[model samples]
Target: MTTPRPAAPSPTDALPGGLGRRFSWRGRQIAWTAFGDGPPLVFCHGTPWSSWLWAPYARALSAQFTVHLWDMPGYGASSMLPEHDVDLGVQGEAFAALLAHWGDGWGEAPHVVAHDYGGAVSLRAALLHDARYASLCLVDVVALRPWGSPFFRLVRDHAPVFGRLPPAVHRGALEAYVGTASHRGLRDDELEALVVPWLGDAGQAAFYRQIAQADERYTAELEPLLGDLDVPTRVLWGEQDTWIPADRAGRLSAALGHAEARLIPDAGHLIQLDAPVALATELRGWLAEVGAGRR
Candidate 1:
């Protein structure tokens, strides 16, 4: 794989800031966008998308809480993980590093909000290092059960071949990458921006490697950790999500101890993008309740 360009200067490197900064943990570099100014609330974006995915909701969330949206290791503005350690455990450790950096001023766990692959990565962190999260909000996340879609099956069979392909072809692949159970379908701009970075040979290779290994190296050990999680948790879903199957909500709801499962009627796998208004409303309410109890 071609070496990744050094992460563009930290968000702090330029621009008078309200929502951008960078942090270096261990030897890894992470880029983040922060909004609001209260106790920390971190958001983790999943595959192909970046922290920018949370912008629509941040408008409202920034009004009441400190919202920190991060570009997971390779997807957004964050630097690529060194070629040596890119598995799930390593990704979770990266998250833990960011959490520690974000929690420097706070005395307890910061509320963690995550979606899709982000949910998997965060759950791994919370499980391996207990007390790292005060509360969690999982949106359209993958649970322990294995229910492979035709797409997933394709990956299982063709990852090696897929990994070697030229990045130029990724432009055509974005449509499939962003497809979800939701009926709205991905808009042109959304699909383009999500896939732009991966259009290069190195980017495409890096992406395929991560996706192919996520389940085998990370999720298999991740599921068992859920039953032991004692943190306040909420699992929300897009009722229309077809990618991972909406039915899995009940299974996740039950497995997460006290986690409540909510369905956003017209939304799909990319719930926040499809129904940011509804997603934010639910998130705000959950945050309110958690805040109230703390008071």
Candidate 2:
């Protein structure tokens, strides 16, 4: 059966500081936003979160680089595909398509800053396409083995049950899940932005759909290709990250030929929320090291 297209985003869907755009990919609409004007810097966010996570960082870095932020196929403003269509492999393909789409106007090979599940997507994209990125920053990404939290496992095992949860039940669960990602709890507004997208029927279903589709095979497939990357890479982790431990950053760095894995103290998995300034500073330094131009 053919997949149904999602409703196009209206002006109201645009975040406070970023403009939203949509692109077609494998019969699904992917939502993205671009800000500032310089070398391209793409931000890929993680599970139960969307491009909204990058708004503050985008503003901070946009002064120097054109920041591109997107909701992966099943999250945020993007279309919620069938559960099977939201796996890591498909997400990689979607990123590849998005990169090619971006290339038409932003000609430079873009720099990438990916977080959480986005790490797997970014890694697979680079491996499958040899995508010519200037530099890559992975923050609390799920790139190593034995990943996935206890909550993730429970949801994965009972997706159908959880997907049918009432809106209030889902909201409580979402807030609780998001709370675990940061050492310092999110502000009311921060929590609202993160939770809003997963609130209604479609949103709640998409939440469980993503968890159900989680698989290690995607990252496992890229394991052999990890050391073969030629692009400069930096792995960043929150010292207090509970979802994916900080040690995975060290392993990821070693796997990528001794690239440094810098730890941000007093931060957790949601570094963008917990410490946007520190994350932005680190990103600026990485861009400078790679000689990516800034205005």
Per-residue accuracy of model 2 over 1-295 as CA lDDT, tens digit each: 9865344343224454444588988789888878787899998888878887777777777778888888888888788756337989889989988899999997678999999989999988998965678888888998889899999999999999998888888889889998888888887667777777787788788889888889998888988789988888999999999888888988899889957989999999888888877887898888898888575
Per-candidate TM-scores read: 0.85, 0.92
Q: Write the per-residue lDDT of candidate 1 for residues 1-295, one digit (tens) a residue.
A: 8855333333222212523577876665677767676677788877656766776665566656676777766665666653645556776888877787768777767888888777778988888854377789998886555744677667656878877765556545645766553367766556555555565666676667666665554677866668888889988889988776677777887877788888888898888768877887899898887772232
Q: Could you say which candidate leads in TM-score?
A: 2
lDDT of 1 at 94: 84
Off by over 4 Å in 2: 1-19
Q: Model 1 — which ten-residue stretch has the worst lDDT?
A: 7-16
- Kindly state the number of residue pairs that clash in model 2: 0
Q: Looking at model 2, which ten-residue stretch has the lowest summed lDDT?
A: 5-14
| Candidate with best lDDT | 2
